[model samples]
Target: MTETMREVEAGATRELRRYAPLAANDNREDYSLRFAAVSFRRWRPFVVATAALGGIAYLADFAIGASIVLSFGFTSGVLAILAAALVIFLTGIPIAAACARSGVDMDLLTRGAGFGYLGSTLTSLVYGSFTVIFFSLEGAIMAQALEMALHLPLWLGYLVSTLIVLPFAMYGMGAIAKMQTWTQPLWIAGLILPFVVIAVREPGRFAEFASFAGTDGTHGSFSAVGFGFGMGVALSLIGQIGEQADYLRFMPPKTAENKRAWWTAVIAAGPGWVVLGAAKQIGGAFLAFCALGVVGAAHAVEPIAPYVEAVRPALGPMAIALSALFVVISQIKINTTNAYSGSLSFANFFSRVLHRHPGRVWYVLVNCGIALALMEFGAFGFLNKILGFYSNVGIAWIGALVAHLVIVKPLGLAPPYIEFKRAYLPSINPVGFGSMVIASVVSIVAFFGAFGQTAAAFSPLLALVIAMVLVPLFAYLTKGRYYLKRPNTVAGPDVPAALLAGTHECLACGEHYELPDIADCPAHSGAICSLCCTLETTCGTACQEPGAEPVSLGMPTMKLS
Candidate 1:
C-alpha cells in the first residue's frame, strides 16, 4: 500500500480500538447485553425471575380496570380484560421462550428475527417510548397517593416519584432485582389486606357492586363496541413482555438438573405476569364499584379513592397512609424497570444511528428526564387517548415480531436461530419493517374514525391481525433471503468454543464480553465487541465479500487461555 493509504489504515485501526471498550469497567449489571453470562451463583434464576415478575405489582391495573368499568359495564370490562390477557399470554409464551433460550434482549432479538440491523432501530424507539410513557403514568399514580396521605402538592409528588428511581436504576439489574425481591412481600400483603377485610366485613357489598350501573347507563349489560375499545386499551400493555425479556435474558443457562425450575421461572416471570394483572384489574373494578358511593363516580376511577375506601372500615384514619405507602412502593418497583429498560433501548438506538457509546447511565438520566417532563405536562389526565393511540403501534410491532419468531422461523421460511451480529445481517429486512409500517398506518387511520366508531374501537386488533398476516406473507414472498447477510464466520478452532461459552476479551480494546456481545471484525483484524462494531463508520465492508465467504485479514486471534 502507498504511504498515504497506510497512514489512513493505521488511523482507522486506532479509532476502532478506542471504541471497543467504551464502558468496559462500568457496572452494566444488566443494562446492555442479553446474556451477560455472569456467575449463576451470584444471581439465581428463580430469584431473578421472581424479581422480574414482581415488577407487575404496580397499581395501574387497578386504575385501568376502574376506568374500563366506568366507561363500559362490569361484564364488558371483564370480557375485555380476559381478551387482552389471552392475547398477551399467547403472544408472550413464544417471545419469552425465544429470548430466554437465545440469551438476547428484545432489540437484539428484533434485529435477528426479521428487522435486520438498522431496520430494528425504529423498534428500539417504539419500545423506549413505552417505558417513558408508563413511567410517567405510574409516577402520576404515586403522586396522587402522596396528595391523599401527606397533603403534598401533586406537582411535587410527581417530581419525588420520578426522581426516587434514579439512584437504584443507575446501578442496573442487580440493584433492581434486590429492590423488587425485598419489597414484594410487603406489597403483596398491602394488596391483599384491603380486599380480605372488605369481603369479610361486608359480604352485602359484593351484590351491590355487581348490580351497579356504569356512568354510560349500560346497567350491567355488555356492549361489543365498548368491549373492543376496552380491549384495545388493555392490549397497549403487550409491550411489557419486552421488559420481562430484559430480565429473562439474564436467566441462568437452562440445565438438565434445573430444567424444571428454569421453565417455571420463565413461564411465571414471562407471560404469567398478565394472569396476575388480569385478576388485579378485576379486583380494581370491584373496588371501584364498592367505592362509587363514597368517592362519587367522578373520582371512582382513581385507584387511591377505591383503595382508601377498601381499608377505611378496617384501618379507619390510617387507610390513606397505608394506601399511599403501597402506591409509592409499587410505582417504585415498576418504574425502575421502566427506566432501566428505556436506557438500554436508547443505548441500542443511538449507538447504531450516532455511532457512539456514551454509556447506558447517561441514557438512564435522559429516559427519566423525559418521563418526568411527561408527568409534569399532565399525561395522567389524557391516559385514555394516549394509550389508545399508542396501543396500535405497540401491537403492530409485537405482532410482527411474534409472528417472525413463532411462525416464520418454525416453518423454515426464515433462519431458525436469531442472527444479531452486525456482520451477519443486512441493514434492513422488508418483512418486519414493511409489516409494522403498513399495520401502524392503517390501524392509526382507523383509530381516528376513518372507518367509523366500531372500526375505531377495534384498531388495535386490526393492527395485530395485519402485522401478523403480513410477516408470514412477506417471509414467503422474499423466501427469507434477507434474514442473514452471511453465516457467522467468527467462531472457529482458533477461538475455542469454550471461550464463546463464557466471557471473552475483545482483541481490539482488550475488554471482556460475553459470547453474544462480540463478533469478528476483519476491518480491525480481530474479535470486535458489538459497541465497537456499532461505532465504526468507515470499515467499508472490509469484513466480507459480496456473496462469497468472509475474508480473513490474517490478524492474530486472541487466545482465551
Candidate 2:
C-alpha cells in the first residue's frame, strides 16, 4: 500500500474506533444510538422489565401529588391524577410494543414511526430535557433530606446527589440492572413504611383527607378548570415512556415459550408504571395532608419532611434518620436512570447533528452537570410551573408518535414495519414531525391563555387531540412517500434468515454487527452498521438517492471491482 494511503487507513481506523461497540472498551454501552442487537439482548423479559420499573422510584410523585391537592383540593386533584394516568397509559401502549418488537430505543422508534431520521432529533431534545428537569427535581428532594439528616448545605447536597449516581449510570444497562435489582427491596420497603405507619397511627386522617379544602381556598369542590389545570401538570410525565423504552428495547425476542412472560413484562413495565405512579401521587397527597398542620403547607409538599413526620409516630426519634436514608436511596435509583437516559438522548442528538459521537459515558457527566446546575438554582421551588409548561410540548411529541404507531400504520397509511436506518430514510418526514409542530404550537398558545382560562388549563389535552388527528391527515396528504427513501436491501424476508441470528461485518468500522444493525451502504458498496452510517458525514446521504455515486469518508470513492 502507498504510505499516504496507509496513513489515511490508520486515521480512519482510529475514527471508527471512537464509535465502536462497548465490548471494545470492556464495558457494554447498551447501544446508545444504534439498534439493540439480538446477541447483546441477554436479559430475560422479566428482568429487563424490572430494571425499567426501577427508574420510576423517584419521590417526584409525592411532590406532584401534594402540589396538585394543595392547588386544586382533594376532589379535583385525585380525579385529575387519574385522568392524566389514563392518557399516559393509553399512549404508552403502542410505543412500548413497537420498541420491544423492533429492539430500538425511543429516538430510533420516532425516526421510523413518524418523524424522519433527521426530524426525530427534535424529539431527542424534548426527551433529553425531560430527564434533566426531573433529575434536578429529584436531586433537590435528596438535598432536602441531606440538610435535615446530615446538616449539609443544600449546595453541597446537590453536588453529592449529582456525583453519587455517575459511577452507576456510566456503565449503562448491565450495572443499572444490578443496582436497581439490589436496591429494589429496600426502596419498596421505604416507599410503603410511611404510609403504613400513618394508616395505623392516624387512621382517621385518610378519611378526613377527602373533605380537606386546598390551600388555595377555592377548590374545595371539584372544578372543571381546576381538574384540567391539575391534569396538565400531571401529564408532564408523558415523556417518561421514552425512559421505559430505553430498557424495553433490550427485551429478549418474544417466543412461544416466553410469550406470556414477555407480554406481562412489557405491559407492567411500560404503561403500568403510571398505575404505581398514580398511587404514589395519592399517597403523597394523603401524607402532605397529614403533615400539613405540623410542617405547614409550604413544607408539606417536600417528600422528606412529610415522610419524616408520617413515620415519627411509629419510630419516634429515629424517624428523621430512616426517612433521610429512604430519600437518599429513592433519589439514587431514579437519578441514575435520569442520568443514564439523558446521556442516551444527548448522544443521539449530538451524533446526528454533529456527525460525531465521543461516547455515552462522557454524556452522563454532561447530563448530571446540567441537573446539578438546575438544582443549585432551586428547581424544587417552582416544580409545578416547570412541569405545567413542559406538559404542552411533551404531550404533543408523544401524541404524534403514538398516532403514527397506532393509527397511521394500522390503517395502511404508513409503513407496516419500523425502518430506523438513515441509509433507507430521508432527512425529514412530514407525517410525524409536522403533526408534532402544529400540535405544540397550538397547545403552547392555549397554555398562555390566548384562548381562555379553560383552554389554558386543558392545553396539553388539546395538544394530544390535535397531534393524533394530524398524523393520519399528513400521511394521507403526502401518500406516505416521505416515510422511506428506499426499500430494505439487506435485512428482510427476501434475504433468508435475515436479522434472525447472524452478524455482518461493517466496512467502515470493520466490526461484526447483528443483521438488524447492518445496512447495505451504497456509499461504501458494503454493509455498514447503523452507528457507522449515522457518523458518516461524507456519504452525503447517497444511499437515499437513486444510482448515486459512492462517496468515500474524507477520501476519493474507490469502486471495488
Candidate 3:
C-alpha cells in the first residue's frame, strides 16, 4: 500500500508538470473549452444580461411571424404567438433560474438535469443543430438585405454575411458582451422606429391589417388547425433559451450586494427574452400585412421588404439603406450568438464523444462552416418545413430537461443541485435520455403526418407534453438511482468553504481551477480539475473503494489531513 501510494504521487506530479505550459495561459482561454469556473466568471450581472437579451432582437422572429400570418392570417398568428410565449415563459423561468444560480452553461445544466454525462451529449448535438440552422437562417436574411442594398450577387452576399460574425464570436463572452452593449441602443431604436412611424402616419393600415385575408385564403379569422400549426412554428424558438443560458452562465455569483441585480438580470435575460420576441412576432405579422400590396404576397414574409416599405413612407429612398443596415446589424448580433453558442455546444459534444478538445475557437469555425453550407443550400427557402420538423426534437429536449429540473429534482427523484462533472455522473440517465427519445420519436412521427393533420400541426406541443410526462414517470420508476453515479465527496463542511469557492491547483494539470471545477482524484490522491478528469480515461476506477458506493469528488470524502 505504501509503494502504491508513492507511485500514485509520482504519477500525479508528472501529469501536472506535463500540462504546466498550457496552464500558464489558462486565463486567456476564457474557460470556453471547459466549465466556466467561479474565478473566471467575473463579469457583472447587468452586462451579461444585456448581452443575452441582445441576441433576442433577431429579425427571424419577424420572418417567423410573417410566414405564419401569411399561412394562418392575423387571428391565428397572434393566438399562436401568445400560446407559444406562455409555454416558453413558464418553462424558461425554472431553467434560467437554475442555470444562473449554478453558474453552469446549458450543456452542463442538461448533464445534471437527468441526462447524464454521455446522455446529455445527444442534447448537445440537438442544441448545436439548432444553432447551425438558425445561424444559416439569420445569415440568409442578412444576405437578402445585402443583395438588396448593394445589388451584390446572392452567393457573394451569403459569404459576406456568414464571415462577418467570425471575429466577434471568436473571442467568446467578453467580446460578445461588448458588441451587444454597443449595439443595443441602435438596435432598439431601429426596431421600433418604423413601427412607430407606421402606427402614427398610417392609422388606416392597422385597420387594413386586421381585415386582410391571407394568401392561403384564411381570412381574418382564427382556425384551430391553423393556430396549432403556427404555434409549432413559434415554439421552435424555445431552443433560444439554451442560447440565453449560455450567456446567463456568465452572470456574477449572487451576493447580498448584488442580489437584486442578479435576479433582475436572470429574469430579464433568461425567459424574459420571449417577452420581446413575442412582440416582435406580432409586429412582423402587422408589417407583413402592410407590405402585402407593395411587395406582394411572395415577398411579404421577408422582413427586409416589410421594414423597407414601412420606412419608405417616412425615409423615402433611404428606406432601403436604413432597412438594410437594420437587418445587417440584427443578423450580426444574433448570428454571433448562434455561432458562439453552437461552438460551445459542439465543443461539449465532441469533447465527451471524442475525448479531444482542440479549442472552442476551432469549433466556432466548424459551426460557421456548417451554417455557411446550409445557407448555400438555400435553407431559408424551406424555413417553415425546417423549423416545423426541428421543433419536435428541440421541444422534446427542453421538455425533458425542464421536467427534471422543476419536477424530478424537487420531488427528490434526482439530486437537487446540478452535478455536472463527468466523474460524478453516469454516461446515461434513462429518466431524461429515455424521455427525450420517446418524445422525439412520437412527435417527429406526428410532425411527418403519421397522425392526422391536426396532430401533425400540434407536434411540438405533443413533444413537450410527452417528454414532461415521461421524465417524472421514468424518475419514479428508476427511483432516481441513475441521477448520480456517486456521492459527491470533494466538497463538504470539512473542507474550508472559502477553499471550495476559491481556486485550487489541479493535481493532474498543475492548473489553477475554481472550486467548482476541482475534484478529488483518488488515483492521484490529490485534486484534479474536471477537464483533466474527463480526459483521463485510463485512470480506471482507482478513485473508488472496491464494492463501496462511488463518491463524487465534489462532495465529502475522508477528512483531509
Candidate 4:
C-alpha cells in the first residue's frame, strides 16, 4: 500500500505551464489525435448556455413524443415519459456534477467514475453511438427540411446538411459556442409559435387528443399493451444526458460567490433539460393531433410536418418559412453537439484501442463519416429499435457513473474529488464496467421477449433500475480498490516534490498542461498533452497499469492505499 501510495503521490501533483490551446488537433504522428489546452479554459456563461441548448435540435423529439401517442395513446405515453424523465433526473445529477467538478469531458469522467482507463473505451463507443446516431437522425431530418422548404432531393439535401457544419464542429468550442448563442432565441420562438397558434385555432384538439387510439389501431387503454409500447418508445430518451454532459464539461468552475448561478446553470443545463424535452414531447403530441386534417395521421407523427401543417392554418407562407427555418436551425444546433461529442468519443476510442491519434479534426471526420454511411444505409428505419437497444448500454454506463458520483463519493466509499489524471489510475475498474454489462444484459433481455410483453414494452425502465442497482453492488464487492490504483494524497496538497508538478511542454501538440494531464510519451520520451497521450496509438496504453480490471467487477488484490 505504501509503495503504491508513493507512486501515486509522485504523479498526482502538477503545475500549469503557460496557457496553451487544449484539445488541439494533432494529426501528425497519431493520424487522428486531438488534445485540449488549459489556455482557453474559461468560457463565458452564455456560450456554455447556448451550446447546451443546441442539443434540443431536430424537432424529431416531437416526432418521438408523437410516436408514443400514435402507438400507445396519451395516458401511457405521458406516464412513461414522465417516469423516464424522473429516472434520468435521478441518474443524471451525479454524472453531470462529477463532470463539472472534475473538469473532464464525458470520456475522462467515465474513466474516473469507475470505468478505469481502457474500461472507458467501451463507454466511448457507447457514448459515440449516441452522438453519431443522433447526428444522422437529426441530419436526415434536416434533409427533410430542405426538401420541404426548397424542393431539394433527399440525397443532395442530406449531403448538404452533413457537410455544412463540418467547418463549425471542426474547430470545437471556439466555433460552436458562438453559433449556438446566435441562433437560440430564434429557434425557441419558432418552436413555440406553432403551439401558441394551434392553441387559439384548435381549442378542442388538446382534449380530443387524449382519447386518440394508438397508431397501431389498437384500443389499448392506459394499461394496455399498445400504451406500454408507446411509453417504451418515448422512454428511449434515457441517454440524452450524454449530449448535455458534452456541453456541461465546459461549465465554468463553480464557486461560493456564484453559487446561485452555478446551481441554476447546472440544473438548467444538466438534468433539468428534460423539462424542455417533456414539453416538446407533449407539444409533438398536440401538433400531431392538430395536423390530422391537413397531413393526416400517417405523417402527423412526424414532428416537423405536424408543426408545418398546424401553423399553415394560421399563417400560410410564414408557416412554411418558419418550419423550414426551425428545422434547419434545430438540426444545426443539435448536430454540432453530436459532431463534437462524437469526435471526442472517437478520440477516446482510437487512443485506447489502436493507441494512435491523428487529431481532433480527424476523429470529427471519422464520426461524420460513419454517420453519413448510416444515412446511406437505412438507419432512420431502425431509429426506435436502435435507440431501445442502445439504451441498454447507455443505461449501464450512466448507472455505473451515477453509482460512483451519488453513492461511492457520498458514502465515503470512494474519494471525494475525482481522480481522473491517467498517471494515478489503473487501466480499468470492474465496478462500473462489469455492472454496466450486467445491467445492459438484464435490461436488454427484458427489452426483448425474455420477459412478459408488458415488461418488454418498458424494458428501458427496467434496464435503468437494474443498472443503477448493479453498479454499486459490483463496487462494494470489489472493495473499491479498483476505483483508483493510486491515491491523490500521495503527492500531498498545496505542493508536492515529485510528479510533474514542474512545468513540461507537450511534445506532440506543443502545448502545456499540468503533470496530471501530461504524460511522458515513450515513443517521443517527451511530455505530451493528455489528448496526445490518448491519441498516441503506438504505445497501447503502456503507461497505463496492467490487467485492465473490469470496473463493474473487482481489481486484483493489489492495493493502492
Q: Write the per-residue lDDT of candidate 4 for residues 19-55, one digit (tens) a residue.
A: 2222333221111222222233477555675677667
Count of backbone clashes, every candidate in sequence: 0, 0, 9, 38
Q: How close is candidate 1 to the true structure, as a TM-score?
A: 0.92
Clashing pairs in 2: none
> How high is the lDDT of residue 313 in model 3?
79
Q: Which stretches of model 2 miss by more than 4 angstroms?
A: 1-26, 493-499, 548-561
Model 1, range 437-521, lDDT digits (tens) per residue? 9999999999999999999999999999999999999999999998987766554324555545555566555566665566767
**Model 4 lDDT, full chain set:** 0.68
Tell me how many residue pairs clash in candidate 4.
Answer: 38
List TM-scores for all candidates, in order: 0.92, 0.94, 0.93, 0.85
Task: Go through the candidates in order and give each one's C-alpha lDDT.
Answer: 0.82, 0.88, 0.83, 0.68
Off by over 4 Å in 3: 1-13, 17-28, 492-499, 540-561
Report the C-alpha displacement of residue 93, candidate 2, in angstroms. Answer: 0.9
lDDT of 1 at 509: 58
Q: Which stretches of candidate 1 lie over 4 Å from their true place?
A: 1-22, 29-35, 38-42, 491-499, 502-504, 544-561
What would the TM-score be for candidate 2 when compared with the true structure?
0.94
**Candidate 2, residue 479: how far the Cα is off, in Å:** 0.7
